[model samples]
Target: TDFEKEIKGDMLSSFISEVRELVLDNCKSNDGKIEGLTAEFVNLEFLSLINVGLISVSNLPKLPKLKKLELSDNRICGGLDMLAEKLPNLTHLNLSGNKLKDISTLEPLKKLECLKSLDLFNCEVTNLNDYRESVFKLLPQLTYLDGYDREDREAPDSDAEVDGVDEEEEDEGE
Candidate 1:
């Protein structure tokens, strides 16, 4: 199909004029890579490249307004640093079901202050020790991790701590 061939080639740059959101899922991209494609969408805010078999995220043009990106179920091994550097306004990212193994690969994300939500649900990195705590410490601005909110965890802890400490200790004093 021309559409498939166009998407697989650098021809995308010619079509995208003012596209804000683009979804190119399951394209079975050649070489499992996406290069020189993103540069076309100048006004792109959201991009979903799910299940595209992408192995790298290089040659991506800086998208200042990009807020959300979905690269789930791809072969992406690394390049979070590039993502963090290029998309400063990115707030949500889904890298689930990938080949990512080391949590340190996410260290670059600390610089992304606007990033609030990250989903690494089925990635191998999720098996690391203290994954949640480590991620929270690295990116404190993140209110959500793997779908769980910081407020949700803190709220229950505060309630349990107050009840256990004040009520239990006061009762024991009497």
Candidate 2:
């Protein structure tokens, strides 16, 4: 199918069968439905489909190894339960700039045990009174909401930490 070919063309490697990360940003989805994907992408760990006009995730394939998913800037309104079922191991999910409005719309995310970091920036839900508290209560499994935890502590950036370590090592060698 054309969808499969598009995914293949975007793959980092020529071998699409063993893709671990795929970015299809700005590509149009079939009316918010993803088709032509298969279990052959079993090794896929990270996927970014930003601005794809997705309205639902019901058609997403089961990706056991998936840890991070970027669906920011889409039209997804609800039905996150499909993510818990399809991307069971997902730890980080970026739904920033979507149409999520009420807290109840996020209730289904409780089923995702591995989910830790969730970003809902620019969503309507962020405007609710006590939004942070409500979301933390709803999804107890989430360690960080919009990059901060219940205590308002920011999540550590791995890349920055690695760079800091490198700088310290260079200083020690001086």
Candidate 3:
């Protein structure tokens, strides 16, 4: 489809099975569990559940095609190992603003061999000594941490110019 399918700020129960992208940020769950998700979403590629009050991700349904998942601003303390199986193809994961406290808590993520980018902004683990070095050592497969690499190079912005397409040049041509 030409248009991206996105469901933002909506109740989980109202989500469509065929949607490829879903954003349910700020939708709270009573038991801190992901409800209303099923294995029926075979086509889903991206999912964002920021600020959803989730304390654990044990309830997530299998999403084999999922490549990017955003679970930032939640209350999650751990139980991330399940994501390796549930979202097997996940390449990017954002767990910023959560309750993660130690680098040991992220050891389970090593199973996610495809994960290239991981963001842990505002998490307690970031305050640990040698945080960046520890994480890079633990998850050697990771290419970017908190948007930067072990070499301290920042990841390119998604909106940055590509293939020399400049707005000023386009306007001048007009």
Candidate 4:
């Protein structure tokens, strides 16, 4: 088959359970779309798909051994709670440059006690408003809250803001 210089997509596709790391960045899927790794390669420990517009991945099969998943630069905007259920062994995750609306989707990750690092650099995150405070509730074993950089575990302030003491209480009733 000289016309076929080389064919090697499905070859690696079926070898999922045997594979711990699979990288198919920028590969055109059967739908003639360049996106994240096809669901055919589901059970991988390390997955990296940079600069790919992976819009949806709800069809992926279970990946129990998956320890690390890197899907940066994609349009992934779905709840991430399912991942914790599917990949209990997940420890490191990177989803930078994607459209992540909220971190509440990560609440389920508390069960993944082994998780150590996570990255969501310039996604659709606005501020540490919604679930950022909740992230500090526990995660005692978490060394690096986001990415490899360890976060400063600051305690939440309990006292309300002291705007201004009442003049009466200040003995200014003169």
TM-score of each: 0.73, 0.81, 0.80, 0.60
Candidate 3 C-alpha error for residue 165, in Å: 18
Which RMSD values do the candidates have, in order?
9.9, 6.1, 8.3, 13.9
User: Can you list the residue pairs that collide in candidate 4?
Assistant: 118-147
Q: Which lDDT values do the candidates have, in the order given?
A: 0.76, 0.84, 0.84, 0.59
Report the lDDT of model 3 for residue 165: 39
Better of 1 and 3 by TM-score: 3
In model 2, which range of ten residues has the least summed lDDT? Answer: 158-167
Please state the error at residue 95 of candidate 2 in Å.
Answer: 0.5
Candidate 4 Cα lDDT to native: 0.59
lDDT of 3 by residue, 102-158 (tens): 999999999998888899999999999999999999999898899888889777674
- Flag clash pairs in model 2: none
* Candidate 4 residue 109 C-alpha distance from true site, Å: 2.6
Give per-residue CA lDDT, model 1, range 15-122, as digits (tens): 575688888877767675565455567789888889987887664567888888898998877877888778998888899999889878888888888887888989
